[model samples]
Target: MEKFTTLTGVAAPLPIVNVDTDMIIPKQFLKTIKRTGLGASLFYEQRFNEDGSENEDFILNKPAYRNAKILVAGDNFGCGSSREHAPWALQDFGITCVISTSFADIFYNNCFKNGILPIVVSPEELEKLMDDASRGSNATLTVDLEAEEIRGPDGGRIPFKIDAFRRHCLLNGLDDIGLTMQKSEAIQGYEGRMSENRPWV
Candidate 1:
């Protein structure tokens, strides 16, 4: 997990609603437990044609958004069965933050664990960002987590809310494993005590 203080990058506009986990990374790709290679399959269905050709009109397939680090999507983003791979694919594809009017609960929680920020904004605010993202080459938004602000290309800022604990996790880059490691010293001490008390076991 990497600390997410602030990010300024290309914002790809995906205005379609109900962008589910399977659409983000088709069900077939879920076989692999490893998280690294899923980037190529992020939005696999919409990105490729029947003959494995890149769909030219899709926002991610466009040249300007090929490296997009932020996504401005429609409502109900990441809706589907609880799959950790959803955020894995997004993070692997270099999307550090996702902005939408709403998100599925499980997917929203998974984002923080995988080092991706899932932001929930009002419908009106999301529409404004969606329009900003329509600019392609000019579509850049600054997400300041510390300040809870999203700055559009025109320098207008929109505020968002997040859970205090989740905010702390992302700010310090502390995933589940990272959080556990923070108590390593105490864990080691406990193990040492157990060894001394139960020599045979």
Candidate 2:
């Protein structure tokens, strides 16, 4: 996982609601455990046609949003199955931050672990962000985790809240493995003592 202190980039407007995990990376792409290469298949169905041609209508396929790093989406942004691949695909596609009116619990938790920021805002706030994202190439939003503020292209700011522990983990680039490593010395000491006391086992 990477540290996510701050990020400023193009905001892609995905106004559709109930965007499930499968809709994100699709079920076929889930066979591979590797997080890489899923970026190409992110939103596979919506981004491609029946013949595998790029869909011009999808927000991600548009030239302006092709490299978008922020996504302003509708409500229930990550519903359905609890697939970790959804966040992996989003992060692989360069979307470090996602702003939505609401999100599924599992998906929201997975975003932090994968170094992606999933923001929940009021419906009114989402409307504002969506309008800002509609500005084509000029749709830029700055997400400052430390400040808990989202700065829009026109210099407007929207505040958000997140769990303090999750914020700390993201700031320090600490995933579950990283968190465990922080106590390596204590774990090593415990194992040493166990071996000394129970050598017969």
Candidate 3:
């Protein structure tokens, strides 16, 4: 996982609600456990047509949003299954932060582990973000994790809340493995003591 101290990039507006995990990466792409390369298949069904051509009507296919790093979506974002691949796909696609009214519990927790920031805001705040994102290429929002503020294109700022421990982990680029590694010395000592005391076993 990468450190997520701050990010400023294009914001794509996705107004449809109840966006499930399957809708994000689809089941066919789940066979591979590797996290990389999933970006190309993110939103596979809605992003492509029956003939394998890019769906022009899709928000992600639009030129302005093709490289969007922030997503301003509707309520209940990341709902349904608890697949970790959903966050992997979003992070691989360059989405560092997602602003929505609400998100499924599992998905929200997964985002932090994958280095993606899932922000929960009030309905009124989401409306403001959606309006800002409607600007297309100019829809840039700056997210400062340390300050917990989102600065919009016009200089307006919206504050957000996050768990302190999650914030600490993201700031230090610490995933589960990274967290474990922090106590490697202690773990090594414990193993050595166990071997010395129970060598017969």
Candidate 4:
């Protein structure tokens, strides 16, 4: 996990709704448990043709969006299956922030764990962001997690809200494993006391 205090980069517009986990990385690419290689397969079906050639129509494959670091998507983003690999694939593709009107609960949670920021905004706000993302080479948006706001290319700002604890975790780069490590001293002390008090066992 990496700290996510602020992010500013090109935002790719993905206006399709109900984008599920399978649509993101596809089932064929799930053979590997590792997270590194999934980026190449992100949105595999939409990004490639039957013969495995690149699809020129997909937003991600377009010249201006190939290196997009943020995504402005439609409603119900990440809707199906609770696959952690979806966020992994998105993060691997250099997209650390996702702005949508709404997101599936499981996928939203998974984003935070993987150091990706999943933002929920109003339908009106999403429309604005999507318009900004349509600017091709100039589709830049700055996400300031600490300020809970998004700054668009034209200098317009949209505010958002998130759980305070999740914000803290992302700011400090603390995943579940990192959170547990914070209690290592207390855990060690308890184990030592238990060993001495119950040696016969």
- Candidates in order, TM-scores: namely 0.97, 0.98, 0.98, 0.97
Summed backbone clashes in each candidate are 0, 0, 0, 0
Candidate 1 collision pairs? none
Clashing pairs in 4: none
Better of 2 and 4 by lDDT: 2
Give lDDT per model, in order: 0.93, 0.94, 0.94, 0.93
* Model 1 lDDT tens row, 67-99: 999999999999988889999999999999999
Instruction: State the number of backbone clashes in model 3.
Output: 0
Alpha-carbon runs more than 4 Å astray in model 4: none
By lDDT, the candidates rank as: 3, 2, 4, 1
Instruction: Find the 10 residues in a row with the least total lDDT in model 3.
Output: 132-141
Error of 1 at 46 (Å): 0.6
* Model 3 lDDT per residue over 19-65, tens place: 99999989999999999999999999999999999999999999999
lDDT of 4 by residue, 151-171 (tens): 998889999998999999999
Clashing pairs in 3: none
